[model samples]
Target: MTGASGNVGRQVVEQLVAAGEPVRALSRDPARTEWPDGVETVAGDLVGGVPTEAFNGVRALHLFPAPEGVDAVVAAAVAAGVVHVTVLSSLSASWETDSPLQRRHTVVERAVEGSGLGWTHLRPGMFMTNTLAWAPAVRAGEPVRAPFGDSVAAPVHEADIAAVAVAALLDPARHAGAVHELSGPEALSQRDRVRVLGEVLGREVRFEEQSRAEARADLLRNPWMNEQLADSLLAMQERTVGVRDGLVLPAVDEVLDRPGRSFAEWVADHREAFTGPV
Candidate 1:
């Protein structure tokens, strides 16, 4: 699995291991990852060197994109006899759209599709785990602030996302050629999410909305986050497409045999993220 040390990717790796699957985890730094026993580790899958050395005899993969050598890596995965490729894609990917993140990720998807391997794309919406970004402020008793407070999203749990990814990778019969837009069971505004966090933690945490200018100034130092991706996410926050209108899916249940978790439950599980160790 590429990006095995990352957020959602980390959960995928843990789930794969717990399910008794032999996992070969790839990261940019092999020594940095502390994987479970029997899991192989390698570095440099998507950059200069081809790390397909670990892919030899592998039957499945959960892929992510990097700055370079994706094509060569895919080719080597094919030569290594990989049967299924499950890509960790976003909900924003539209083939005809002209967004940079979408453009680049779609290019990677195309490479996988053209590689003649069985593939499934997991398109998850905003992650509930993203709220952990506000944890430090919550711990400090400061209002959680960001642009687009009025925007709504189905804030999906990362565990649910990983559960579905495992289902797709291990059993492709129902998910092949399908795009699953994973989300939480309920639609919530940013303010509402903060309130829920406060409730779960037994503290009345506050939330404030930042203007676009403020967001831009604060994020200027983030070299990896370009303006286009930030703007697109902000816009999605402002006027969300799928919400109470029920554009959501039962894919999680169909794949994992259960409905996705609600934000309240997510907050409860992650109360420690806001409150820290006792």
Candidate 2:
């Protein structure tokens, strides 16, 4: 599985291991992190060609969306006898808008679609983990600040996203050619999420709204984010403010046969992030 060290990918690795599946995990530097017993760790960079040996004897692949060299990776998977592929994609890719985020994921999705292998696209909306960035502020007894504090999003847990991917990988026949749009069980405004966190932490977690410029500058602080991508994300947040209709999807429940986890549950599971030392 590519990106085996990432947020969703790590969960996917854990779930696959729990199921007794022989997993060959690929990452830029496999030695950086330890894998479970019996997991075959392969050092391969998706952007720089994935080593052919990584796909050897592999039946299905969990793919990460690294646009560079993606087509070649799919071709290599096809040549190495991979039967199915599950792509970690974004919900923006399924939207009608042509934002950079959508276009970026779309490129990878298109490559997988034409690969002649069974494919499942896990298009998850805003990740609940995005709020992890607010941990420092919460831990410092300050308000969690972000733009579009009223924006409504059903932020999905990374676990649910990975569960769906694991299901697709294990049951290719049942999930092949499927596009799963996933989200949390309910839509909540950004402020509401903060309130939920407060309830979980037994403190008054406050929300401080930011201007668009401030949010854009904050996003640009990430080395992985460019101006175009940051602006695209900000635009998405701006558009979703107070949006209550169709922001949530049932694919998570249908695919996993369990309701998507609520934001409060996510907060409870990650309470330490906000309560830990600075």
Candidate 3:
């Protein structure tokens, strides 16, 4: 697994562990992590490069897409004799507007599709975990802010996405060439999710919609954001506000042999973020 330390990657690691699958985790900083006792953790930088030897004994890998230079990763995985690689992609992939993040995924997907390595693409919708972006304000008892609280997205659970990844990794024949469009069991607006959070936490949470100008101003104040990315975030909000809903795949149930989790359940399980605890 490439991003064993990230949100989705962490969950995928946990699922792989429980299934007793021997894994070779790909990580940028091995010292920072305390991986499970039995798993072999490799210390190397993915952004810098993915070491070909990491895939030496590995038959499959969980990979992430960053634009920098992943041709090396494709070569390394192929050289290591990897049979399959699963990619975590997003709905922004349609590329009607050329989002930078989408561009990164596009680059990696194009490379892997022709890289001679068998592949499966898991394109999940808006993440329910993105609600964590509101954690600080939610814990502060303030309103969650966005440019379009009215935007509707059939967001899927991160764990569910991970589940699909683990499923495909373990059973590559079933998922090869499959592009799963994952989403929550139900379609909902941003406002609807906040309302769900409120219902689950027994507190009234509110959303404040910032105008495009105000949104840009607030985003620019952050040192980490550039204009293009900030504007793209706002643009996604604008695009999703009335686009009906995205495709919800049954691949989850078919692959995992159980129904996928729901947003309300995800909220209920992780209610601590909204209930005053960090």
* Most TM-score-accurate candidate: 2
Model 1, range 1-278, lDDT digits (tens) per residue?
A: 88888888888999999999988888888788788888888876577675547788789988886636678878888999988888888776743556666776777788888999888988787888888889999988889998877667777889898888899888977677778777677778777788888888887898898998888766665787778777765655666533356636677777777889888888888877888842
Q: lDDT for each of the candidates? A: 0.80, 0.92, 0.81
Worst 10 residues of 1 by lDDT: 240-249
The predictions' CA RMSDs to the true structure, in order, are 2.2, 1.0, 2.0
Error of 2 at 98 (Å): 0.8
Residue 116 alpha-carbon offset, candidate 2, angstroms: 0.7
- Per residue, candidate 2 scores C-alpha lDDT tens digits across 1-278 of 89999989999999999999998899888889988888889888999888888888999999999998898999999999999999999999988978889988999999999989999999999999998999999999999999999988989999999999999999999998999999999999989999999988998988999999999999999999999999999888889988999988999999999898899889888888888898
Q: In terms of lDDT, which candidate is stronger, 1 or 2? A: 2
Candidate 3 local lDDT, 2-88, one digit each (tens): 889888998888899999988777777877888876778888776787666787888897878765667888788888888998988
**Candidate 2 Cα outliers beyond 4 Å, as residue runs:** none
**Pairwise TM-score winner, candidates 1 and 2:** 2
Q: What TM-score against the true fold does each predicted structure earn? A: 0.92, 0.98, 0.92
Two-way lDDT contest, 2 vs 3, winner: 2
Decoy 1 TM-score against native: 0.92
